[model samples]
Target chain A: MSELWAASALSVRIAAVATLVTVLFGVPLAWAMARRKFPGRGILEAIILMPVVLPPTVVGYALLMLFGANGWIGRYLGGYSIAFRLEGAVLAAVVVALPMLYLPAKAGFAAVERELEDVATLMGANRWQTFWHVSVPLARRGLLSGIVLAFARALGEFGATVMVFGWQPGRVTLPISVYAQFEQGDLNTALPTVLVMAIAALGLVLVYNALASQRD
Target chain B: MKHALIRLVVLSAVLLGVPTARADSIRVGAAVSLKEAFGEIATLYKADTGETVEFVFGSSGQVAAQIKSGAPMDAFVSAAKKQFDDLVKDGLLDVETRHLVAGNELVLIVPAAAVKGGAVGGFDDLKKDAVAKIAVGEPKTVPAGQYAAQTLKALKLDDAVKGKIVFGANVRQVLAYVERGEVQAGIVYRTDAKESGDKVTIVATADAATHEAIIYPAAVLSKTEHGDAAGHFLDYLMSEKAVAVMRAKGFSIPTDPAPAAPAKPATP
Candidate 1:
């Protein structure tokens, strides 16, 4: 079934874009969390970790309420409806994968020697340049880990995706396709997509391992 | 390991990325409930016409969404008229080619061994002490689940079995849950029980009067490239050979007008 391939392609696009979104939002937040003690910092950390602890179905239900047709946000964005569309799938992936990116990034940033950023600052590097040129390179392993892990998690996102995006053309991701085929009692038909995902996930883990060990 | 991954990528690219539809084949999006019956029908259809009818099976609601979003299905066979009618309103179906493929009866099923002692007899018996959990498809998307809810409500037993109901995503899932003995019983089409062989027992058949009439409506898609082939496939669904296969699989020819769903919902 071509559905399998379409789903695979959809999954990749959703995850890749989702990871980019996660990095955009998560990395800055990770830096703040790692370096600054803000008001209600504990609450922020709890919310960031909640996704990993919550049942995916509950997360899906919560998202459906926030992004469904009748949801306030959805109603306001009628012309740009995210529900039952590719954007909704990417949003779900981004939401679920955010913490996967944030935790590693925070740890990576924290592990970066403060002295390096201080040295860069002393050597006439501006705050932005020092943070980007010094802190980023030093935290490379953790950042790479987060990206790969986030991408993998995003690629496999399903419950929230099916709840918000629903299963339709331009939106059916790999997991949903596999569910549809298996629901039909067609295991043979579901196998190729399953294999693709399995191999892809394995490859990501290897990539993460290689990156983790590169310095050693 | 790297080579293996590379080969898998290329193999899947060749096998799944490219279009699987041939000029002579018509891509059909069908309800998953037809998996067994249509598998047999497709075989007979291919033998008779030498045309491959590639079926993409899912819940009726799912198939409707696919048709709405333009999944390139040449035809559709919906489990009920609501989905079919929805497609009609969306201007996705070739209304002239629509036909009633069969009428199905909703039945109560249990693990084959559970009823060996006749512990459960009917819908009312689902509330019995021995039955702890009953599986039904989620009524929102799965048509059989909606029908099951209606059947229980008509029998004034919905309230009694409400707490113990375990919602499966689809009828096959409900059947599987019952077969695995994960649930004491399930409500599904009689055809499911037929395919299940000895894995599950048909404990009781719901009376037709208790719920909306179950119907399967088949139609060619409006945007089909192989319109002629799709129309012929619809015709084949009505042919004697296809009917025989359907009948053998426990589907009954409907006496009602084709596409006129006998439910309170508007007929397709």
Candidate 2:
């Protein structure tokens, strides 16, 4: 159905955007956590990874407080409202998916041979150059797998997205559509949407596994 | 290691046995709005009969779907007749046990701070430029949302306010949005508005003529093995004691006389 296709496309877009945002911020934060021995590092790591352990609804509620009209951050958006919009859904997905991406990316950074980075640095390469050339290439597979995992997680996100943006027609993702169909007792529609999501998720996991298993 | 494994198995068995060994239990699926009232009634029912009544609370549509999927619920108390009717049509519920229990009123609520300005008087005011967003449950899945939509349509304001609508998954979520001041106004049950304390103020009660009757219907499932117990629970729900509890929670008890309790079937 056209509705199903639209919902699937929207879900993919939301997840892709969320995953992109996650990687942009997560890679650097993960690298810093993995490579540094800074003070408060333990607390910082716990805060980054908190979403993984907390209930999705709790994360959603916290986001709601932070991004709501009366919220501290939301009040200063200068008349631009983020709640009940596609952007809010993306923000929700990023909150829930960030930890999933960060953890694996952190592990990837930690797994990279530090000696190679040091060698690159000693050869007159700057820190940023050494990181991109030596550290990133060595950990590319793990990082890619992490990105895939985060995309998959974001695609299936429901609790936080619902809490933050509710389920607007043009903004409803695949998971929300499936839930709405099921709740409306339209099993005919719900089952196929579920199947599509399941297959897509399986495909994502397969890609991740393939990338992860590749020998560098 | 072998002795410890045997001990662990024995411990697990004992833990699992504790509940099944006690009083007979029945699973009742009720709408989320009925949670507090039903929980109190459940406690009272347990005190009187020594029976354990477990409740599964969710949106009426979701609960009905579970019943259709053959959820092991002994009784279902729904916030809407459509869900009950659907189950009856599917032969999942005993038609004879179905009874209208209580009624609720839909109300428009605004954040407490907004009430002073009086900028929002009713559904028409929602079209004002100052009202940025309005929250209502998703009409496709929530009964409260259906009523809200009906009311809006009746007032001919559906088209005018269509763009400002934000749908919550359920009535409680709508209430939350209003309570948190995330939306300028929200539509929810009067009871839900009451629960939000000082955070929200009721702006108007939707006219009953605008929407179908907001009724709660209770029924026993045909698939229940504990038919007698389920029937008894249904009877208890109609009793004056339960009616009082429902009333206290802002529900209007049905005026119809209570159905006679069914005779308990002989246990094998």
Candidate 3:
């Protein structure tokens, strides 16, 4: 029972941080791609959306090359190794869930009428101000749904996370715990953990649907 | 609906739980083969001593590699002597704390219904047409597979059963195959066979002499911060109580003190 709670706590914490990071990077990129057409825009979109189509193991491998001690990105970080730790898990989740948020948020941004932004600019609103005040408010539903979708995707990520940070004590997430228990034939424990994840995912999907529903 | 977005953001703020301080727990890296028994022992250990034993179960090689790279494990329990010896050579494991926890026998298991059939009796029977596929661990990686291969070669049955063998990733997968009747039989650790309960029946024990000795060795990591705590848990694993649980799980207790039993009570 305590194992269940510990796993849940660890998972929620990792996924929360991952979701926050996803939105931080995802929202901006999504908006950019949604608003302007730049050179290599198709290539950029393909890369951003690659994670959604690629197998988690492939994504995990790419991240490993970037973050692993011997890899380019990792070599620069010096003494900070993310292997088998919270940060690694968060990174895996963010990579895998980024596209989920980006896709919907792009749609949300695209749905926002260009006239509204023009109206804000005409009223002397700066680009940043118009973004926060007019663009964001108009695209609220798509963005909200995207955020929820990303959160749910991150919560369920397992393979890439495992590949990035192999299993570790004090780092067990709900999916990992369930897999561990099931491997040991301990269905009694695994079943409850599975139930917890199922409920969590269901709740997130509900939130997504609620936000996506147009009340006006 | 009016402030739904604001409420949702607040909700995420709560879900973004503040990182809590780690509890008084020692992280132990152990072989994947020990997953079930070790988990049970950890649970009991927590009950007996209010301290926790958190584990990271993986292949002996993977776990050892992690330890070498400074994976923050307080203790290590390897499924084979080779991995333990390698770590000891690297001065990663405390030599003094190292001990032989248990040894294991390779068991041949078949689906429950096939147990009584005369069609499959021993290693030789695996060659028969009735046994279409016989599951064993991949000899290159899985310890159980290596031992099973050794046993067949030692018993002069390797050529006879070679064509019928289907390799699994690990002992647990072999047991799963046997339990599902996907394979007519499987060769896996005794503990794995036992975990399947009645779903699979042990057809034969691949005598210990036929293969290299299967040993599980444990020791504290020399770099561990909680040396005393990890040592205590290691001692508990070799304690009479924990040994009893391992024995019931079908593991061989090699150095277990001769049990004080088989004598009638004086009163009786």
Candidate 4:
């Protein structure tokens, strides 16, 4: 029972940190994808969606190259010695879950009625005010779905986290610990870990479905 | 007539090249520590025999599972005796063709800065709060894990170190844990610790008698259609050239007494 709490707490931490990072990058990207009409919009969308299609290992290695101790970003951050620990796990999770957050936020942004923004603008609301006050409230449903889905996606991420963090228990998130257990053939120990993850996944899906309903 | 003869020669060359190209490409499941060394061997093998060797370098347990579950493999080189023995028991390996191709030593290593070049210390320090985490291989599948567990039990430190012990999926992972400074110390094969270079610190060597002798075995799978080719590869793995490569990679020569029955009694 204590072990279950420990594992669940770890999972929740990973999901929360990943969610926070995703929102930091996701909202702006979603806005751009929604409001900007650029020449390479199709290519940008494809690049953003690449994680959904690319092998998780490839994404992991890319993350490793970008954030490994000797990696470019990693070295800069290594002044603080930050990669391949809990922070690296969160970063890997964020990269994979970013698209899940971005696509839905973009859709939600798009779904905001143009007339509401027009009315806000005519009422002396500036662009930023119209966005924060008008646009966000109108499309809250899609944004909520995106956040839930993003958290769920981050929670289940195994490959990228494993390759980046290399399964440092207690420091790495839960998916890695599950994989290490599986590799060790302690399926008995692993069963609880799997159950916890599954329930979390199911909870996220339920939340997404509820928010999606609100959107409809 | 001349043009038709030229076409015939070109067609014959293409047909022969196609089969030889396919035949030359052979896949071998190698232990993780051998990744770079085997890559070099593969190049040599290609140069000498025109055979291109592809290696899937990972934990021997993982490679063995993959092979047992029908991964297309011609040969398997494992870091432990049990994996090969189990493969033989599974009827996947040709029983008569197995060989003890190499041996490795498990060592207790710490960050170099932690211990001032001391000839490896005793386990007494391991229990101290100063030692926050100790990395070790998972005992179920990784040979290094089994050896480390056995050594711990032999020294009666298993219970003492239980809380501070962090399990790695393989010996390499154990090294990574220590190298990344996530763990204060770790147990890995001497080869693996060496592979970490200055990233890790080696505190001491585990007495060879403390646990079972670490013998690595290699064998050709019975299901291989290229049995002759695999047999040749196994021969190379046992040859002087291969021994030199293994030695350079930190595989010890088995000079100790025979491996005891594994720590836990065999399941039978």
Candidate 5:
């Protein structure tokens, strides 16, 4: 029973870290995508959407190649022993979860009326001030929704995390733990972990739907 | 869209139907290490006896767990004894049907590019700062990991080398790490090191005295509906015919107190 909670708790921690990291990077990227018309916007969008299209294992292996001890970046950082540890798992989760947060964030930012930003700018406000005071306030609902979606996606991400982390118990999170327990035929241990994930996932969806309905 | 959907449905149905048509087949769960070797034998057995045998292969821990959870398997061939003992405790194995069929030995392995000074010699050199990482199986679930842990503990080097340990999911995965040069060294079965051909070099033979005996055991499950067929399969494994296949794959014949394997030329 404690094992199940420990796994889920680690999953929650991963999702939280992924959500935080995504929003830190994603919102700005989304706003840039929404507001700026660049020469390679389509290519940029395609690159951002790559994780969504690729199999989770492919993403995981890519993460492994990038963050693994002998990986390109990992080689430079080998002195630190970055890959296959819990930190690598978090990085993998964030990579997989980025698109979920980015799509909704871009949509939310795009839906913000250009006139409001223009008016704020006309009042001598700078770009940053206009964004915070005018654009962000109007797109708050979309930002909130995207955070929920990102959290959900991160919670459910398995393949990439497992491929990189290799199911190091008490370190990697819920899904891999359930898989390990299931493969070991410890049903008494696995079932409760699965049930907890199910409930948490369900709770997030329900809350997201309720908030979306209220916003509507 | 509808035509594509119909094609998908038909494809899925055909896939599902093929396995169900062979309902009388005995599903035998064996270790991943035995996949290529046993797959060859199973094909021969089917042709010779006209009895279909289907095999599902993975880590011994995984196979044992699957059998315990009522995975509809008729028999189990495990790479380690602990899993078999667990099944016996669960009363899932037929008491009279059990036998030790094959044996494996642990060896240190390194990438072909790395072996120097006539192999690693012993565990002392493994702790050199130049040795950045050392791969072993996950100690909890893999037999190789258990043996590696036992060896390290016996040498009192477990604590000294704790920080350098990077776990592979199984013996094969450990071999993969060494083959790719992802780690400085790894521990895997002698057969794995041999079968890897030129990809990896055997570094040293881990002494059997350092760890528990590594034995492969086979048994028919008590729940097997086709008990007669299962018994015949077990008998066949012990027969000279199958023993030759096992031996050719670097497995030794099991004995009361397994003899020390003779040192041999490393796989070229």
Candidate 6:
């Protein structure tokens, strides 16, 4: 039972950190794609959205090769091994959850009325000021729902996390814990961990649905 | 929409029915560690008999669990005796058909770069702060990991290296971790370590007395529909041709007489 709690807490921690990262980068990228016109825009958008269509295992394997100890980026970050650690699991979740957040956030940024932003700019507000004061407030509801969906998806991540982190018990999240339990032939333990994850995911979706309906 | 749905259902039905339509094949569940050897043996069996032998490879414990859950397997080749014995006790396997196939040795490995000139002594060196992480398969579910744990405990290094251990799903993953230099060292089968080419070098071989014998056993499942075909495959697995393949892959073919033990089935 305590093991389950530890796993649940670890799951929440990884998902929360992943959701924060998704918002930090995803919102800005989605904003640029939505409001700006540039060469290679389609290609950039396709690249960002690739994770949504690609199998999670492929994404996991690619991340492993990119961030593994001898990996291109990892080799330079010497002494700070990311693979087989909690940070790797968090990174896997962020990569897997990025598209879920970005797609909806992109649509929200596109739906924001251009007139409101124009009015803000006309009133002497800088572009950055306009973005925060007018654009973001209007798109808050969609972005919030996107965050929730990304959090739920990150919490349920398995293939990529396992591929990158290899199911270290102390650092393992809920889905990996469930898989480990199943592999160890303890379905009794796996079922409850699965239930806890399912209920938490259901609750997150419910909150998102509420926020989405309230937006109307 | 309804017409498309009907077409989709028919398409899926035909796709799912294709495998069962060809009933001449036999499905064998084997440990992932036996993949290279069994793959060659499978090819040889096909060439000689013109019969198809499909394989499902995974950790021995997982394969055992699948067999217990009534997986469509005609034969099971496991890397550990416990899983095979458990199945035999459960009456899921034909006890009379069980035979020792091969054995393996466990060894400690380090990345080639880490071993500059001298090897890192033995189990005690694994405790040095410089050796941050050590990869092993999940001990409870993988036979190789079980052997590693047993060896560690025997050497009294289990407590010393507790926190530094990172578990993989199977032996191959452990080798990958070492090959990629993710961990300073790892414990895996001698065969696996040998196959890792220039990426890793053996530091020490674990004493066989430290752990249960690393044995491979093969048997026919009681629920097999194709009994004669399954029996023939079992015989083929013990044939000289198969033994040669196993030997080439570094498996030590057992030459000892079968042990006499209580043959009572589990009272489930």
Best by TM-score: 6
Could you tally the backbone clashes for each prediction?
A: 0, 0, 0, 4, 0, 0
lDDT of each: 0.81, 0.85, 0.80, 0.77, 0.80, 0.86
i-RMSD per candidate, Å: 14.4, 2.1, 17.1, 3.9, 3.7, 1.4
Winner by lDDT: 6
Per-residue CA lDDT of candidate 6, range A94-200, in tens? 98899888988888899999999999999999999998888888888878889999999999998888888776656567888888888888888688888898889
| Candidate closer to the true structure by DockQ (higher is better), 3 or 4 | 4
- CA RMSD of each candidate after superposition: 15.9, 4.4, 18.6, 7.9, 7.0, 2.6
Arranged by lDDT with the best first, the candidates are 6, 2, 1, 3, 5, 4
- After superposing candidate 6 on the true structure, give the runs of residues whose Cα lies further than 4 Å from its correct spot: B1-5, B20-23, B48-51, B117-119, B261-268
Cα error, candidate 1, residue B225 (Å): 1.9
Clashing pairs in 4: B110-B201, B112-B201, B120-B203, B120-B204
Task: Show model 3 residue runs off by greater than 4 Å.
Answer: A1-216, B1-22, B116-118, B256-268
For candidate 2, the share of real interface contacts preserved is 0.70
Best-to-worst ranking by DockQ: 6, 2, 4, 5, 1, 3
User: Per-residue lDDT tens digits of candidate 3, residues B1-268?
Assistant: 8699989989898888766556789999987778888988998998999889899887676678778878888999887777787888897988777767888888988888667666777787887888766778756446787788899999998887866776564577677666755467889888887788899888799988999899888889999899999999999988888998888887888764323323432553
Q: Give the TM-score of each candidate.
A: 0.54, 0.83, 0.50, 0.75, 0.80, 0.93
lDDT of 4 by residue, B87-111 (tens): 8778788755666667778888876
For model 5, which pairs clash? Answer: none
| Strongest candidate by DockQ | 6
Worst 10 residues of 5 chain B by lDDT: B256-265
Each candidate's B-chain TM-score, in sequence, is 0.87, 0.86, 0.81, 0.82, 0.85, 0.90
- Over A1-216, each residue of candidate 2 has an lDDT whose tens digit, in order, gives 788889999999999999999999999888998999999999988888888889889988888777777777877875355678778899989988898889888999999888888889889999899878888888887789889999999999998887777766555788888877766667687887899999998999999889988886
Per-residue lDDT of A18 in model 6: 93
